[model samples]
Target: MSTTQSDRLRELLEPLVAAKDLDLEEIEVSRAGRRRMLRIVVDSEEGVELDACAEVSRAISEKLDESDAMGDEEYVLEVSSPGADRPLTEHRHYVRAVGRLVKLTLTDDAELIARILVVDEAGLDLEVPGVKGRKPTARRVEFADIAKARIEVEFNRKDQNEEDVTDEKEEEA
Candidate 1:
């Protein structure tokens, strides 16, 4: 897609995303035969549910229908969540995944499973467990070296408690 189209799409979708309490992870426009495809990926703090996706899909469809953003051509509008395996694209994505385990492949073809300790202007600081007699090491990797990374979901009661506390704080604030 051209930069102009991408920018225009972002302008049109930002408000919709905020109104729906969703993060606009990506917007892709591609040609599929005679029709164009507009794919919108959204996510929420607790993960996006099917109903939420439907709602956003409906809203976006309406907006597109009303605005003629895709011109006179026919188009398909799809709204969905960026699944569990979605790459961490934005700094906010990394922030949201903090304290969660992630598998990242570095540029050197080395893979590491570590808890995201911190995210700063530089990049991600990860904590990887060490071998016997060796101290755990922390690596500060520039975002560029991170070829691929995804959160590792684990069923743990402690995580539930932490989420609850976070929810309470959000409510209070």
Candidate 2:
């Protein structure tokens, strides 16, 4: 889709998303043969609920129906949550994934498995484990060369403490 159309779609969807108390992660419009597909990914601080997805889907469908954006083409509208394995695309996404393990593929044919240590204007600082004669290294990655990245979910949950919970609650408060 054209940039203008993409911007217009974002503008149109923002209010609907806000009304439903959800975050609009992305909107994709694609055509396959004679059919068009409109996919919307939405989320929230507490994660997305099925009712919220249904609500946003209904609102977006109504708006699209009224605007006739597809111009008589049959289109399928699908609304969903960015699943646990969702790709990290934005700066905020990277920031939120900090302290979690991630697999990143760089442009230089380097694949890294590391824990996200920090995110700053310069780039991401990842703690990569040692190999052979190399010590555990913290590498700074430019924001540009990250071809693909996603948070790695560990099967084992780390232990937490009362102090940790208290600190988190204080911060939220």
Across 1-173, the per-residue lDDT of candidate 1 in tens digits comes to 55678688889878998899998888899998989998989988788999999998998888878886778988888888987666877888888888788889888889988888899977899888688978878978888898888887666637768899999999999
lDDT of each: 0.84, 0.83
- What lDDT does candidate 1 reach at residue 104? 90
List the candidate 2 regions with Cα displacement exceeding 4 Å. Answer: 1-5, 31-34, 129-137, 157-173
Clashing pairs in 2: none
Give the worst 10-residue stretch by lDDT in candidate 1: 151-160
Q: Model 2, poorest ten-residue lDDT window?
A: 154-163
- TM-score of each candidate structure, all chains considered together: 0.73, 0.72
Tell me how far candidate 1 lies from the true structure as C-alpha RMSD in angstroms. Answer: 5.9
Per-residue lDDT of candidate 2, residues 1-173 (tens digit): 55665577888888889788887889888986789888889877677889888988999889888885657879888999997777888887888778788889888878888888999976799999788978888889988988888887777756357569888999999
Candidate 2: global Cα-lDDT? 0.83
